[model samples]
Target: MARTAVPPKKTIVKKMNYLTGFLLGFGLLLSGCNKDDDGVTKPDGPDPNAANLDVQDFMYKAMNLWYFWQGEVDILADDAFATDAEYTDFLEANPNPETFYFDVLLFSDDRFSFLSEDYKELTQNLSGISQNNGMEFGLVAFSNSDDIFGYVRYIIPNSDASTKNIERGDIFIGVDGVTLTRNNYTELLFGDNATYTLTMANITDGQISANGEEVTLTKEEGFQENPVFITKTFDVSGTKIGYLMYNGFTNEFDEQLNEAFGQLKADGATELVIDFRYNGGGSVNSSRLLSSMIYGTNTNELYIRQRWNDKIQAAFSPSDLEDYFAATTGSGTPINTLNLSRVYVLTTSSTASASELVINGLDPYINVIQVGTTTRGKNEFSLTMVDDPNRQGAPYIYTPSRENNINPDNSWAIQPLVGRNENSVGFSDYTGGFAPEIELQEDLENLGVLGELDEPLLARAIQEITGAGAKFDFTVEMPAEAFTSSKMFSPLKDNMVLDKDFYLPEIQ
Candidate 1:
């Protein structure tokens, strides 16, 4: 059948005036009833054949309602099925919710949509709480060979790695004495092993070889990271340039981030350089808040416009589409904005999603001098969709407050690409990622202190700000290209999340 899916303006029959119903309003009545004609329950409704297909219902419905490429996926199309039975059958066919989410429901173009088995875990991850080893590192393959090696990007303070001999610029050629390759790096370094030994590598006269030293690290739950890594002001040709090596846009650290800005402001920083080299991404609101801290807190100035799927868009009012520059931190602390015209951003392959959002969202308002490499090219924002127990089989955007309301039957939550975010000028096309105006890459040979003026990326930004170039060699030996990082493993950190208070069209 030809699927000409057109969005209905008023489709939801709200059971009650509640956020639960409002969030679950878009999808069709999701209660699975096998009997075709009347209100009678069919004996076949509890088909043993449909066993383990429980959460796929939630997954399919959520994707159908909110997925950015919903129209492109044939099964998710509004008219794809003739009856409720057909849709139920499809959900049953794919018993595994993860398989259904990854294989059947997702668009081929989607690169970042992910699912967590438990909404609790997912929420924790988005909040920057997780099982961590305290080591923030990047994994890359040798330029001339298939041998994979891990490098310490930075160590999270009070963590196991910080207590160990490992420090930034250190490389590990193996984990637990096993030589790392492209295939086994994930298993060796990131696997379930609570503790593992990292065999260090030595750079002797331009060649890297395995050294005898090994560092053992352990993973701990609820390990939270402060995204505001290091804040320092530099004297660049008498111009006070504020340097903020921000790692993630974690909302939990919003107030701390604001305070960091306050410090920069107090330091008489006329110029700003934000190092986003190792950052992947995080909360969109946090990105907005951070943008507000850098730019002015002009509440009237639009920060970002959320571009939802047509189904959602058709129901939204004009005002519901845009999010403005935040005036206060999430905790009601007044933002200490720099109000600077020009800002330098240090970016790399790891700088993605919400990290990219800050650059794109602020472009029409300021001069963003991008240093280092191109970004990871994710312009889409995702909503964490989980089953709402109050409304059976209905998916609601997961919020920390409504954790108890999540379906006890289904722990599954999908972080699906529900929208593409645009700036005030309606520019969202950074799928190929924003290229650097000043092309530079971090030298593996000379990985300097992050907050210090010696870091290659920071030095270059200072050069641009001061016009008196920092005395640093631009040459790189064994230029590393990261395949993945510790941040990449934390999908929630990389996600541009839209959580509670997000604009949902009023269900009339």
Candidate 2:
């Protein structure tokens, strides 16, 4: 049979009516609060700084170019009745309005907002000032480099002490008094740090929850990084399992990974469980490095293929391909070809971007298993941080590129690539997420296995790797008719096992 080539799928379309309704409602909601302290009315006008600058300058100077660019593009393409105004008209008719608008807004409002908020929080935490321009904080790093670590280190307000309120050594226990556990902390910390009243005991205190009691500590200036933590190896039956809890793909993350893997391997680790319940994304290179280490040199292809705009395609140099290939085959100890793979990844709605990349990259070569909910469908790769000429420093912008579709021959062997811009290309293997071989949830009220550790997910994964039976099983008798209609009653089936004895599949 001749196989038909699948066109890329369209991006998910959200109903704009709800958005329009919400905007109108929000306007009405704020209408009553528009008065100043003396009850005098105020007029809406661009700030002096914004008014004096060129439109290009305003657009490029904004920090969040991604959101602003989309809005500007909509104004140009959708708002046909709009006057042929200076900056607005130029953006609408441009060859790549999305990219151009992203550059402009990224320079103008987005940059200013991000810096302002960062500064505002810094001042509020340090000087207890209610009003400030909010200029003290800055982005320290953002990349998908060789290392898988992303960081946003802000300067302490009005002090150069080696350690600020939330210094390098402080362990993050909670955010806004919401206690964080292994599973959801990654999503909570990504992007801007939320307002949190943190409580901390001395690191050496070794504190555990008391009977009907909680510890309340002092408030301090703090920042949150993508959640990444290390824990002790535990025994499931007779097998030893090493756990590495990863939250996101940050720069230089591979180094941290290597150290964890090395320690676990030395400790006679036989199985590994990686938790990605709330990870969003950071670097593709970081994902590649981890995949390479797990699959080893014998594996040829890393990712199936990346889709990008024609401009991006033209920009690709020979070194880029070479570097990608080298990164996939260069690091880590080789896995025994004959061994059954046992890797458990916990996922949820927040598991997206590079998280999907890791799953698609490793599934074909290893005994990969997914636990928990479906993954967020975000297979489209975007080139963010484009430079804008109007900004003083580097004008960082995020733009939507092209679509990527993996060849069918390589789809199962390599990771599946679903198009974010097109609607027809469905991710059949795992779009919403891969269903876990075993499902479990923790009970938070009892704090038994669910306090943030997600004991149930971890325990089930450990059981599968160790070949251990369930510690407790409760069966409720049900009617046959009920069983027939329930999706949970579906018959068990066999999966097509990839033959490792055969040659590794080549990238088509």
Candidate 3:
């Protein structure tokens, strides 16, 4: 399941109502959401004074109010700025909002928080829609130099890369015939160009060199990737093992995910394996539902606990502080549950955010046999917010009920680390990422086909399952370090996000 919120520090929060009394009177505190015509609750634009406020003003106010580490950041103190002028001056100190956001507002410990130039793009990204060639690959640096080569992880079906000659396990050392180096790779490969060529490479004797091959790939506009990448059932000595190579916890594809689970259940699959080796993360709601499908749909059990900031968490009851196992999809469709007690999770450095959530949240309930390498160590989740005038887009879930109410003044959006997610037993400390029980890393030279049972990670999992197979050598010929993956280029990078619009509970 997608994770959200860390356990709050030891601080006594008084019993307060939905914090309509937020002490900061900078006029940036939410006065609560507004209802539009037909009496539907919608986002309110910023406060009256926010009309003239710049983007930095928006960033500072949002960080001060909702940043998970607000209590620790001295600059974010409620009384740090005694006068409104000082607050405004602090915002004005950095004219560039992005600069100010990175260098100042964000907590140093936070690694996954993000800011975007356009909320529309950010919203589409969180939903798994983006402009892309759809070749999901990971970059690895050469052992000697800053030069990096990319190994194809997987190809998105119906994508430009899918039609091209490039496939999983292929290696590329350059873009448009230019040898890729650390400094110019971003500009050459991920620039605004709609199309580019990948210069193929091969590794031999621990030496990576160009193979004199090139493939041109084009970025498709509005490419929508389904998170349910590969789903199949493996018959292992009369025991049915269902395998799902899920890529993200995207909420828009929840129906598809449910259907995949339904297929596994239909196949009489008793054992389950979820391959998240390359999955970064997405919607927490989807993660919760996905977990419920694997585990039982027991609404009584807590799936995840959220520890909000002291300013607002006091308003929540114990029940409100937690997200329980869902009985059905948020759309009310009955979930197709495998109800498996033990699950095998395939992970890598790229398996992160919600992927880690599934591992951590289910740890207290089920046997999660994590294979492959450790994860990307993100225990926090981000809230999708736009520059709404209403408390500067006070984080509400990016749901249909409310209009995003984006301040027409700007197109910027911010996904701040607002909560720390813990499982039922209060285990939220995987910031260094979850270590694998079956410590294995992908063999770059022999990156096998994804689902055909011969893929190294999956094969190793099968070995652990059937118990009749001989051991295979886990060796790597490439001498390099994994830098990043193709998902890093996506607008929503390593995010396990809260999609439900959260306006503070009806102000008492």
Candidate 4:
């Protein structure tokens, strides 16, 4: 069971189709009763009969105990409502339950905590499963302008977009033949549509203008997304430069990632460039493995320190808080450690979570030359908690379960910010985001093929490695009349997460 950590807010996930089978099961189990506080059988026990009020009660109690900022929730001591309806009425009159219970209940300025009623969809997302059109994009506008332009960052292979010959660096100015204004872009890009017609654009006189090329693409169910998008070794003036365009920290492809590193090591690569411009983050274990491979022979060293809430801190031992690097996978598979003294990274505002972890975790032991724009500042991680009473345990439960691991009957689950992560030597102060030593934006003016030496961001990294020592600027002036979407097109929200060995058992 992998914990779904909060990704950079910019990533846009397509709305999921609920599991009809689960809904049917929920409907069938609604009549079953459970032991309430008085040990009397009641209609609400994590079942469909558990109304919104019942669910809210569960959420309140769970957050009171497990939330990282539990002490700040003054409402914890006010759970004195006699019935579910009374509790509902109290919440309605509070005027700030949503704010107090959900948003403000987290550490100040935290935006990672999220609630979901679709546990199946969330679980699938954690496992790298989702429906996607296979195009990842970034929205850019001139400073302080509402007008935005759509920039193609990358295209997933074998996706509908790729099949339509849509390539990285392609710019779109309109959707469905309508000029893309900031007002209509979100609806046009993320609308519930089976198909889309994209109008292309080109840079003319330093301005984005319509190119009159329309490409129609359709969306389909993309089951599993492999994070290893591109891996190659570039020969840069006799220096073997290894380049890996890794996008996420999914554990399913651990072996494949190891193989990529193995290839670079076997090729005797002297320099490395990790492209994380669009990576939001994923599995903490995967982060550790990647760091271990990069750190090479430095296995037992502490990679990250996870600090839970004060209550959980006192309950768990020191061993539970420390996450160290494993030279090999748990099954004793030896990882390919690059053992490089310095590693170059390409980033953007979207580079976050486990991606930042890799960069920060390796900083103490190696020279991490950050290239490209600043990274998304997310140092905290979250865990997915369900409505299982026993799992939430003691003081938090009013409806006790007779069985130990009975699954929940409803889909409600919460991915709350449970802990903050720090690297070795306690270096975790990058809230505003980590800026690049060699700052350069992606060259949308003259987009180059990805994994190529001439690509704007990658080119800068190579230049740094070769000691050419030249900095390039790719920032463009904001268009006078443009619109940008609030969020970029992220196929999935499950980026960098901490993989939990156990999951709250399935809802019955």
Q: How does each model score on TM-score?
A: 0.86, 0.47, 0.85, 0.79
* Candidate 1 residue lDDT tens string, 148-227: 88888999988877888989999889988899998888888778898999899987777779888888899987788888
Q: Which scores higher on lDDT, 2 or 3? A: 3
Off by over 4 Å in 2: 1-228, 235-237, 314-340, 380-387, 390-437, 446-454, 473-508
Q: Model 3 over residues 242-282: C-alpha lDDT tens digits?
A: 99999987787899999999999999999988999888887
Model 3 stretches with alpha carbons more than 4 Å out: 1-53, 117-127, 391-412, 469-471, 479-481, 501-508
Question: What is candidate 2's lDDT per residue for 367-410, written digit by digit as tens?
Answer: 67777656554444322222222212112221112112211121
Candidates 1 and 3 compared: the better one by lDDT is 1
Considering every candidate listed, which one attains the maximal TM-score? 1
Listed per model in order, the count of residue pairs whose N, CA or C atoms clash below 3 Å is 0, 39, 19, 17
Query: What TM-score does prediction 3 earn?
Result: 0.85
Compare the candidates by lDDT and give the number of the best one: 1
Q: What is the lDDT of residue 406 in candidate 2?
A: 16
Query: Candidates ranked by TM-score, best first?
Result: 1, 3, 4, 2
Q: After the best TM-score superposition of candidate 2, give how far the Cα of residue 469 lies from its true spot, in angstroms.
A: 2.4
Q: Give the Cα error of residue 46 in candidate 4, in Å.
A: 16
Error of 3 at 12 (Å): 30
Candidate 4 overall Cα lDDT vs. reference? 0.65
- What is the lDDT of every predicted structure here? 0.75, 0.36, 0.74, 0.65
